[model samples]
Target: MKIFDLAAGADGPEPAVATCSRKACRSEASWQLLWNNPKIHTPERRKIWLACGEHRAWLEDYLQTRGLWKETLALVPDTSSAPIGQDF
Candidate 1:
């Protein structure tokens, strides 16, 4: 993964915000690990999917085996202003 240091005091456009890709899972906490895995994605880019608390483990395993597990960050969908869900 190409890790870049954000310029000092330079908060780039709040990051490319996205919603969970899963339809059955509605909780905003749903997120997938987006990173470079030689077995899956290219090392120079970021990839994402949706995973709720119930599917976190399974998703992690899937990504880990492909060697793409870089970081699991929490996300809040733009549909609501309030904290909609909790991360597991």
Candidate 2:
């Protein structure tokens, strides 16, 4: 299990590939863990932690213990959005 820095995001360049939030796992993320630390963030604010199939349960358990887990959802790629381009 890798110690991942969630804020750092996937280890890559533009058009970033979403990877598991697990420290060192490079597997593509399959689930989105949406949560918020009520003590630090606003109620409406949500922080996302991506998880691959293998780490989903572990991550969820971690967050749930802290009472931060709000919801988990399948990570569906957004096809409607246009890819990043040089020309704006």
Candidate 3:
């Protein structure tokens, strides 16, 4: 439930702490929600929302309802070159 503010990412000194975007769950994030509103944002503009398995789908549905859901990506380790399944 602790959301990392992107404001700390713009020329700031702190690093982004990965956490679930769920309202009440403080679980670690396992997925990334890539979204943007074309009507008010550029095609290249992407906003990110991190979520755990239990909440990823719920968050995606919320964005889909508003036509803002672009893609859902699994959060994996950097050393692994394996691709995540796209069955979601």
Query: Which candidate's lDDT is highest?
Result: 2
Q: lDDT tens string, model 2, 1-88? A: 2453455467622455668888888898888999999999899988889899999999999999999999999988755534422110
Lowest-scoring 10 consecutive residues by lDDT in candidate 3?
79-88
Against the hidden reference, what TM-scores do the models get? 0.48, 0.72, 0.66
User: Per model, how many backbone clashes are there?
Assistant: 0, 4, 1
The whole-model C-alpha lDDT of candidate 2 against the native structure comes to 0.79
lDDT, model 1, position 50: 58
lDDT of 1: 0.58
Poorest stretch of ten by lDDT in candidate 2: 79-88
Total backbone clashes of model 1? 0
- Model 3 global lDDT (CA atoms, 0 to 1): 0.76
Q: Provide the overall lDDT of each model, using Cα atoms, as 2-decimal numbers.
A: 0.58, 0.79, 0.76
Clashing pairs in 3: 1-25
lDDT of 2 at 72: 98
Error of 3 at 68 (Å): 0.1
Considering lDDT, which of the candidate structures 1 and 2 is the better prediction for this target?
A: 2
Error of 1 at 69 (Å): 1.8
